[model samples]
Target: MTPNAREMSESIHEQMPRLLTELAAVVGTTNVLTKPSQQQSYVQGALEAVTDATVAVVIPHSLVALWRVINICAAFDVIIIAQAANTGLTGAQLRMEIMTGR
Candidate 1:
């Protein structure tokens, strides 16, 4: 591989473990997963019920873990998409999304 590719790989390798460790610390070992097989049930959407999410899922087992996850996104300024149960009429989750940027 090229130097740039190697550097990128190394960076990802370093950051991924750090983030996973942090997540596992906040949450528990059962909630922190890297295996697709174990997480297969959770990957589905409520609406579709079987629509497999293409992204990683972090299920916070406690309030502290949830807060840490939120803080991490805010601190990093990541553009996040928050979804709620579709049972609501409309616009319920939108308010939370708006306040998240602040």
Candidate 2:
């Protein structure tokens, strides 16, 4: 990875716990998923070539919670991949490798 990318990755790793906690507070602990198994459905797209690289899948049930999540992500400079219904054919919903939320 590029130096900047690597640095960002390391930063994300270090701050993950706090970030997750903040996210859980905004939504709920049960809604934030860090496990690959739980995140598979959100990260996977229609194309087989696309890989799942998300750090977490956050399920916000309300518009307020979603906005809070977005704000938090912006604060951390975390990349966001927004998926709706998980049915996009071009994989536009699965491009980023960081936060995935809906």
Candidate 3:
């Protein structure tokens, strides 16, 4: 990985648990996914060739929840990939690979 990417990955790794906890509080524990299995759909797009790289998948049911999650991620400087329908062909959604949600 590039140096910047590596640094971001390390930072996310260090803050993952806390971030997940805060996200869960905002949208509930059921909406926050930390497992690879649960995060599969969020990371994988329309193309099978695109690798799954997200560390967490957060599902916020409302705009309020979405805003809260964004604020929490921003506070930690974690990159977030906003996804919907998984229709995009480009892998820009998973570029940073830290978090994805809808």
Give TM per candidate. 0.50, 0.78, 0.76
Q: Pick the candidate with the highest lDDT.
A: 2
Please report, in order, the local distance difference test score of every candidate based on alpha carbons. 0.53, 0.78, 0.77
Tens-digit lDDT track of model 1 for 5-59: 4464465556766666666776776776677776554444345434432224567
Task: Write down the worst ten-residue block by lDDT for model 3.
Answer: 93-102
Error of 3 at 102 (Å): 22
Model 3: how far is 49 from its true place, Å? 2.1
Compared with the true structure, model 3 gives a TM-score of: 0.76
Model 2 regions lying over 4 Å from their true place: 1-3, 46-49, 93-102
Residue 17 lDDT in model 1? 61
| Candidate 1 clashing pairs, residues 3+ apart or interchain | none
| Candidate 3 per-residue lDDT over residues 1-102, each given as its tens digit | 445766766767898889889999999999998788887777776556666567688999999999999999999877777877776743665553345322
Better of 1 and 2 by TM-score: 2
Which clashing pairs does model 3 show?
none
Output the better candidate (2/3) by TM-score: 2
